[model samples]
Target: MITAQTFKRGSRPRPFLMGILNVTPDSFSDGGKWDSPKTALAHALDLIEQGADIIDIGGESTRPGATPVSREEELSRLLPVLKELIPSIDVPVSVDTMKADVAEACVALGASIINDVSGLGDPDMAMTAADCGVPLVLMSSYGDPSTFRTQTIPGDGVLYAREKLAGLTEKALEAGVREEMIILDPGIGFGTSPGQATEMLAHSSDFSLGRYPVLIGPSRKRFLSHAFPGKDPDAATAEACEIAASSGADILRVHDVGRAAERF
Candidate 1:
């Protein structure tokens, strides 16, 4: 089993359950539910009790047509909650961001992992990750949220994700980020069509699991909305977790930690 030492945080791995904590008010799902620090921290504690191995906090909404939040606003929403929860939560905290400054600040505030949806597209991201001595969870996506919704690409999503991740891996290596500190994510629903997302779900083995542990973040994604019409997004998320676990994904980034834990 891959452990934190296998990646950036020097963390030990045991079927990591990454709980999603979206601080934005416009996230595709459960956006406004936990916008406050008190509510967010309570939810985080509940996730830990329900078996979340990691807490992934995000301030910006990356959903389709989502507007970007300013760096100051993003940090304002994130740092207070992080400062309050970092000492209270037992699991490692992963700050979900693409901005170098935001990531550096979060790491400085005790975040153990950097979950970059851009796959370190920012030139300074890798350097900051290396400097912070934290593990980086790099997700493979072709474009930002707005562009992702409009773009289309061919081939299996897993294959494309693998190719993109391979390039990013090389870049991170060149930037002095240790290979063991990097984790690969297929970026479900980020830039893929529903068909491609399903293909990746069915064939996640195409990713380079030997080189880096695979992280599958399919919780309440738009692809799931299309795949399981008339089903609850939470149930669909649980289903995705089962599929991911069986498909060799080492970690599952999800919103419903309790349900996913039961499935696991």
Candidate 2:
């Protein structure tokens, strides 16, 4: 199970596995397949059996150009799964949301981590983390989460991501979230073109996470298509995960926990 201490710089294991579970109907990958609470809970349990160290559940889709769901809609899809999934799973449960109300509700019901892909787009999100004292995953992206589509690309992907992440980290710090309790995500494919995403992945260690652990969510991102054209997404994702682990990423957020656990 994951705890605030589980991600402390010196105490972290090498590339712990975080399995993805999207309960939305529009996520780029595996959407609509587990939108129901029963199916979602079943998948979460299977992830644990597959050697997942943490299970990440997201209600809204963050795919590029995807439409955003209302807060009420997100909670309706999310809360039910949490209510049934948390008590049934043994591994730490991480709620993937950018809204404060959703995070609060999940925490109250036993979520141990908050993986907000919006990088605190919601004003009250920072305090939600501070007040709950749960580990926060601050992901860097330019546009809205549902549509992380970007018309402009940064010249230096590393510098751009570092600056974005640094700013978000500052916000989290000011909100009273401990540095050790924070985790950094490069937000691969979240507002980046294929090249930009690749550049950042190649130099993940240079993000200089220090006390804050770095998590790389390369799973089945579309960018993988460029890296390995003929390769299946899972195969491409596995290769990318290997590169990320060798590059010093502390956590690997993946779709296939069984394959990842076996490789790592």
TM-score of each: 0.93, 0.94
* Prediction 2 global C-alpha lDDT: 0.84
> Top model by lDDT, which number?
2
Structure candidate 1, residue pairs in collision: 3-13, 4-11, 4-12, 7-181, 8-135, 8-181, 9-135
- Top-scoring candidate (TM-score): 2
**What C-alpha lDDT do the candidate models reach, one value each?**
0.83, 0.84
lDDT of 2 by residue, 176-231 (tens): 88876788898888778888887778887766555567888998988899987999
**Total residue pair clashes for candidate 1:** 7
After superposing candidate 1 on the true structure, give the runs of residues whose Cα lies further than 4 Å from its correct spot. 1-14
- Angstrom error of the Cα, residue 31, model 1: value is 1.7
lDDT of 1 at 187: 87
Worst 10 residues of 1 by lDDT: 1-10
Q: Tell me how many residue pairs clash in candidate 2.
A: 0
Which regions of candidate 2 deviate over 4 angstroms? Answer: 1-5, 8-13, 145-147, 150-152
- What lDDT score goes with residue 31 in model 1? 84
TM-score for model 1? 0.93
